[model samples]
Target: MVYENGKAWEKIVKWFGYKLHLIVDATYELPIMYSLTKASESDIKEGHRMLERMEEKQAEILKRAETMVANRGYDDTKLIIKCWDKYRIKPVNDIRNLWRDGEKTRLLTNYKNVAYNYKGNVYCYCPETGT
Candidate 1:
């Protein structure tokens, strides 16, 4: 797997090795926390563990955070809800298109005009244009 963020790129090719999950303060461009795990470990699982650890030990830092930025690898529904409901921190993570059956957009419940794409981007359908 290749984790690409603009100019910085991290490639995970080795089968038998350790993976380092590091959380950084983006404003300062400094690392705040880290976790080392086996290469087989899932990013979502590690992400939950990291959040738990932060809540238990360094909650002050978590409280200061307004948003948590992550890649699609960490785009689990539960994790996203947890970040918002528990800490009130908005998650700015990339979403993966998990839609099967060639779904393009899903209409929002209770809102006739509003619909969202697989990426969670909301849009309004025009009745006149039939769009």
Candidate 2:
């Protein structure tokens, strides 16, 4: 089978290979489940797929699990909500810097006393030394 496998650019090296997504237990730090896909496959989608696979392959573990902690890559509202509404698992994913606690913009390009939210909201500051 031929597919459009993705490319990865890391630092100064550019290469083409598959992406491996792994899920591990928080305490034991051991592998739980994993899936390989094209480099272009998104982290959130792959992560969700891994979760669904767990539902079938490891129902016992899923039943005892309470939260799925993920990095900012899976910091999607819809996915988080779905994890809660569908599986009753709380997604403890961290939002990107754009949504950092009461912080500024995503890019923070040449702007001061100005902050932007993920949902297209803007915050204005008085510039009075952390106001």
Ten residues in a row with the worst lDDT in model 1? 1-10
Tens digit of lDDT per residue, candidate 1, span 1-131?
34465465656576798989999999999999999999988999999999999999999999999999998989999999999999998999998889986989998998888899987789998867868
Superposition error at 42 for model 1 (Å): 1.0
Pairs in steric clash, model 1: none
Off by over 4 Å in 2: 1-15, 97-131
Please give the RMSD of candidate 1 to the true structure: 10.9
Q: Residues 1-131, candidate 2: write the lDDT tens digits.
A: 33457655445545578888887888888888888888766888887788788889998887777888888988877789878987888888777666447744553467777777775677777778666
lDDT score, candidate 2: 0.78
The TM-score of predicted model 2 comes to 0.61
Q: Relative to the true structure, how large is the alpha-carbon lDDT of every model?
A: 0.91, 0.78
